[model samples]
Every structure is written in structure tokens, then in C-alpha cells.
Target: MAHRCARLCGVTALGGSMTRCVLATLLLLALPVPAWPQSAPARPVAEDPEITAALALVEARLETERIRRKIPGLSAAVVYDQQILWSKGFGFADVERRIPATPRTIYRVASITKLFTATMLMQLRDAGKVGLEDPVTRYVPELQLRSRFADSPPITLLQLATHTSGLSREAPMDYWRTLRFPAVEAMVAALTQDGERIFPPYREWKYSNVGYAILGLALSRAAGQPYFDYVEQNILRPLGMHDSGFQPTAGLATGYALPEGDAPPKPVFQPDYGGYGPATSLYTHVEDIAKFISLQFRDGPVGGNQILRGSSLREMHAAHWIQPDWQSGWGIGFRITRIGSYTAIGHGGGIQGFRTDVSLIPALKLGVAVFTNTNSDPDELTAMVLELLGPVVERAQQRSRPAPPPAPAEWRHYLGVYRTDFGSRVRIRLHEHRLEMVPAEEPAATPVVLTAIAPHQFRMQGGWASGEVLRFEVDSQGQVTGVWIGAYPARKEALPE
Candidate 1:
């Protein structure tokens, strides 16, 4: 008998069609039937030999950068088409104890745990257990906002997922110093009555750890299980991420290096476990995170195991709300950004002693996961990996196209002084057919290259802060009226009268 494979919403379905029964009968009579959907045209996977070399270079560069940056230990993983192509660890996981980092070294993932919490909400939605648009009061009637506007717009699960709930970055309670976990009711009372709204709901994007923590509490109530247990049963168990978990005190890498300014002393083992559990307590290894990324690429389970419904995964990865100027958007559990033509989805996390980033490029079926033990700049490591990976991916894409012409010069109209609401000013000037931006406040005065993407869109290249886009808006007189410095929204300032 012949078997057929069917696809629905990026998931594979097999052995359920009527044709399979007919094929079985025909095989008994020694007759051949038509091929099934499994025989459909196969998509060619793009490969770049340079990727291997580029990854090697990236490994070496990361090692050098870690030392130069004073990062004690780090681990990284790269995946192509849902397959982990490389996973390596460098430096010392615990500098004092002289323990080297490995793929299994556990590091605090910080707010990346928000992604997992958001995914849990999506799963509940798929099971008809909850609705994304449901107000927070539905699950936790005590949940409230410090502002009256909280009742006006009515914070929903969707808003929390995308950070549009207008909640402050944290609750009024000093969870870290208190070191005591508050009951959901107590937390809700504090947030509703004492928490101050930093901005109007949906008016802007402000990353909020409190928003996600609220969602986690709601999910826990809806599932009738502890938050960690629900995530373990629904997400980790099915995905086979055995090395990933909450609490994270047992399996942590020994001799973990501590940052400079924190209290308790250097090389302190068993760091304080504050009350910030739902938003920052997750501890995971590179290999386990690689598995999670693979599941994202497949939009299903790992190793042919179906964990999440394909439609649910799509909803999770889809852009929920875009920031002004389309710099980036927030998906349910991911951040969507365009690199050239490919849309990458992922999130970055940071805490006292760890920094992590995970991104998946579905068009290319490639994923990048980076974890560092020492508290340092995560953006720098992520940029280096992207720089090394971008060219290799582009070369592979070139194979399926014709050689393109060089981009035209785009530095004439946007040279001016731009001011930001945060009391920062940037001076942009044209130099040798290129644009240079110098922060007015910095003393070094190093000129950074700005590559123009469109009429008003540009990116800073080849500097400490690379890959950030700068967009300019012009008025009727062709004067620069507004400028968006980075992923944040653009703030327009009036020209001098």
C-alpha cells in the first residue's frame, strides 16, 4: 500500500486519506496506484560552503571578543533548516572554579522566559481553554492597573503578549530585595492600585516584565496547574527539552562568574533567588535552546513529534503590532525584524549574570542561539553572529538569482542635527559619498558609517553599534523634520523658528 503526506498550516499529515485505503487494496491485487501528495514537488534547500568557514571565523571572533569584553564564559548554537549545524561553548562557566562552559552549561535566560510564557498562553488558546482577547479580569479578577486607563482599554492577553498593556516595567513591590514571592492576589492588588502606567495602552511600545508576569499568573489559573508545571507538561515535555526548567538552582554551571557591582562578593556560588520567577527565572543550555529553535522552524514538534498545532505556532510567530516606522514589530512571543528581505523572529534576554539571544529565519530555516554567563552586552554578541551569518546566507540566496547592481549613493538630503526626547542629539554629515553620525554627547567623536536602505531609511554599519536603522522624514520644504534613531519610535522636533 502507498502512503501519502498532506500539509496543513506548515504541519505534515500522513496516512489518513481515502486514497491510502484504495492503494492498499490495489497492492493486494498486485496493481500500482497513483503517487500521493508525498510525491509533490520538493523544494530545493540552499547551501553555502562559505557558511562553514564563516561559522569557524565567528567562533574564533567570539572567543577573542569575550576576552576583550571581560566576559567570563559563553555558549552559542547555530541551526540550518531546523538542524543544529554547530553548537559550541567557550571560556569559563565559573571563572573562580575554573570550569569551562559546555553546551549543557545552564545559564539564566532572563526575560527570554517571556517567550515561553507567551507560548503557553497560545497553547491555552488553541485548546479553547482561553481567548487572546479576554480581559485580564476574566482569569484573575483581582488584576488591575495603576491608571484609570487600564479599565478604559481593558488589558487583554494579546496586549500583554505584545507589550501594549501599558503596564509598568515591574510591579510596585520590590520583588528582588524582598526575596519573597507574593501570592497572585497580592501581586494583582499591588499592580492595580500602586503600579503606575508609563504610557497609554497601545500608544507606544515599552518592554514590560510585569506584563508577562501577569500573563503567567493568568495562565496558571486557567490551566489549574502551577505555572512551571504547565509549561513543563505542555512545552518542554513534548519538545524533549529535558535540560530546560525553572528554579534552575541545581544544574547551574559551577564557579559561575559574577558581575562587578552586585552585592554578596565576587564568584558567589548560589546567587540569591529573588521573587522575580516568572519573568526571569528560566535556566537552560544551548542544546536545549537549539531544540526549541528547531521546533519553531518546523512549526511543529521536534524529531517528528507533534507538540503544538501548526496554526497556533503561526499565530505565535506572526507580527502582532509594528513599531512606528516599521523598524520592528512584536509577535506573540517573538520580535519580527527584516534583514534585507528575510523576516527573522526571536528575542533577546538579560539579567544580573547572563545574556542570551535566539533568532530563527524561517525563509532560510536557519536559527542562531547565543548565551553568555557573565553579564555583558548581549547586543554585541548578537551583532557579531549576525554579521558573520548574514554574508553566508546572502551568498546562498545569490545562487538562486542574478548578480545585482551596486546600490546607489544615498547620503545627500539627510545630513543634519537630530534631537531626541531623551535629551540626546545626533549630528549627521555627508563624508566621501557616505553618511556619518556622531552622538553629540560622546567625547570620542568616532564617525559611524550609515548605509541608506531607501529614500529616508539608513543603517549604521561597521561600528560598536551596527545594524541599527535610521529613518528620516521630510517636510514640504524638503527639510528633515523627524528622525528615528534605532528600533524605538521616531520623535520629530520642529526646526528653529
Candidate 2:
């Protein structure tokens, strides 16, 4: 392959401090079939030490976090290239019954629901029934809300989808203590009748739950059915997310809260979604959530149904507006977060007693979903697991990949210690006619061989640096001066030959 290093190579002591494993089983099962109707996934089985060790690290973090946060229930899953590699749960779904949590355990995934809403809207746009640039007035002519920038530009669907519409964060209604949200027509009237003036269209990024509520209303009007109905028929049923819905299902985990004072776990409060089911109402377990995530990674349905065209899904991932304070951007309904060099495009949700995070690394075809009860945050844990996972996958790929081509005789001229200071030197040496590199302090350390892809630049063949390039620098005297690996450069030692 032209880009051999791009393969999911094995893990080592990288960003996550993972231990290197020489013996790893191949992850080369045929491309997995998509998640289907009520179908349970294959049980996780890893004979590879790398995968096993990575999971052990994740389990340790999960247990510690759950105990520290006093979480009642938690569930998580790891996916790669359309396959669910690991799915597990911890703590309890019911404390009284002592029910052990599992991947199938249901939790109200919260605002991750917006991704679904965006999917439906994209579907409408794909069908030519609606346009993203069109004004909300086209669909819901009843909107009473006003904008100070009315003369500048009317709010468009794209702005709402990207959270730049300048709409209020939510509908003005009494849904909180009562648990009874206003009907769709009532919410429309609430915005329009009051003539509430918003910040200004596309002036700055401002997340608005009410704006999404308006989207659901317009989607309902455009599709000639309620948002929930359209989603169920077109998305949930086809995607086989039978356990997901706008209301709690049978056997769903009870929400709980741990207050500041000494008190038993109590039920959590509900902030009425106010007929805006798209912004929050959806509930599901990791099993079902994994199905939706797997679909997002595929270009076209390989062994399953293609929910949306791959191109459209790619369009949704494009960063539209940035949140400088957070150092992240918004991509349609997806919330972008930096995961080292990769970008995790997904969403996180926080209800009174629950917290949720769903992330996808498109470049790696990896997705992670973490759900916790009693409002524990699993974000840090999830990031740790992802960082570890990259190496694990890379290791597996390295083992399966072909060996590197031997280096030419000229390569010996570039072999030596390279560093800014001798105490912190990196050694480059010739091994079996292949160029290998390692830190000077560890002579027995696993050396990653370089594969020649150009005249002076080569990519690593294995270990942590696998697929990364090293370009040797030459001085005016035609002497090797240094080498650049990734973004870091080091000078060659000036010792006698």
C-alpha cells in the first residue's frame, strides 16, 4: 500500500503509557456486518496481549471513577471499522435488585439525540423537500420570534444546525418541576407570539435547545408527520434501534442523584424538553447507540443498511463555526473535541442524574460511547481509553503488515546519535540492512525500522513510530546534519567516525 503506516498499527508506550506487546493476534476477521434489529453482538474475546492490556487499563479507570463519583450505573463500548470490539457495563441498574449493568442496559443518552435530529434533517434536504439555507419561516410560518438583525439576514436551517442562529437556549415555558412540556403548537406560539428578539443570525455560536425544537417542528411540517414518528419509521426501525425512544422503556435504569449532604440516592429532576424531542428526549443503551455510530464510520453500507449517503455524512462533519474558548468547533449537530492529533466529532449530555459522551474518530474509524448514572463524567476516562486504543489497533496492524524493504548502502552514512544534547540523544543504527531508531538510554528497547518511501525520507515500519516519517538533513559539505521525525528534529552527533 502507498500509505502502509495508516493501518491501525499496534500500541506501545505512547500518549497513554501503554506497554508494548510483541505477540498480538490479528484483528483480520472479515468486515463485520452492521448492527441489526435486536441482534446481540459477538462477545468480546481478545487473545492479543495488547488488546487485553488496553482493556485492563480501561476497566481499572472505570472502576476507580465509578467509586470516586459514587455513580449508580455506567455503560460503554469501543468500535473500530464498523465492528464493536468491546461493550461492557458497570455498577447497578437497580440497587435494590443488585442488577449488574451491561451493554444492553438503557440510559437516557441526552443531547446525543441531536445527532439523530440532524440526520433526519439531512435526509429531508437530500430528498429535495427542504434546504439547509432556507429560512425557518418557510416551514414553520408561525414563528413569532424576532431578530435585531432582521434586515441583515433571516435565520437559516444551517445556522440552527450549527448553533449560530442566535435563538434563545430554550423555549420559555413551565416544563421543569411539572415534567409536562408544552405541545409543539404551544412552543411555536411561545417563540413567535412573544416577538423575542434574538442576538443576531450567524453573529456568534450560541447553543439553543429551543432552536432545535423549532427544527423538529419544521421537520414535522415538511415530512407531514411528527418528528418522533418520522424518526421511528425512517431511522430507528431501519437502523434496528428497537430499544431507543422518546420515553423510558421497560427495564430502563432508574435515574439517581447523590447530593452534598448524607442522604440515600434520590430521583433526579427533569428539565422538560418542551416538545423539542430532538434536543434531548431520546433514550437508548450502548448496544443500540453502537449501531448508529458504526453506520457513521462507513462510506456506504458494506454489510448493513446505509442510513445516509456517505458524502452527506462527511458534509455534516465539516467544521462550520469555532468556539475559541473551548478550542473546538461545531459540525452540524456534532460537537468537535481535540483527541491529540485526531478530532472526536460527537456530543455529550448531562441530565440531573446522568452524564453521557459519544465520540467518533473518523480518521481511525473508531467510536466511543460512555454513559454514567448519578451525573459522573466519563469523558476523561473515555479519552484515556481512546489514546490507548490507537496504539492497540496500530500494533495489530503492524503484526499483520509486511516487513520493510532493506535500506541501501548509503543509509550507513546517516546512522549515529542525534540530539540537541548528548544526555537526551536518539540513536539511529543500521540493522539487517534496515534503518532502526530508539532512545539512547535503552539499548534493548524495541526499535522501529524505517521504510524508504522517498530519496531521504522514510516511514517507520513498526512500534510507536510506525507510519511516521523521518527525513535526514544534509549540510553544504554533503554531511548528515540531523533528522526530522514527525514535527520534532534532532541534530546528528559530531563524534569521530
lDDT of 2: 0.75
30: Cα error in model 1, Å: 57
Candidate closest to the true structure, highest TM-score: 2
Root-mean-square deviation (CA) per prediction: 19.7, 11.9
TM-scores vs. true structure, each candidate? 0.66, 0.71
lDDT by residue (102-133, candidate 2, tens digit) is 89888887788889889998989988999999
**Candidate 1: tens digits of C-alpha lDDT, residues 134-216:** 99879888775656454456788898889987777777887656556565566668877877677777888878877777788
List candidate 1 segments past 4 Å from native. 1-48, 146-151, 178-181, 249-251, 254-265, 268-275, 300-304, 397-497
Q: List the residue pairs that clash in candidate 1.
A: 81-365, 94-255, 144-192
lDDT of 1: 0.70
Note the Cα lDDT for every prediction shown.
Answer: 0.70, 0.75
Candidate achieving the largest lDDT: 2
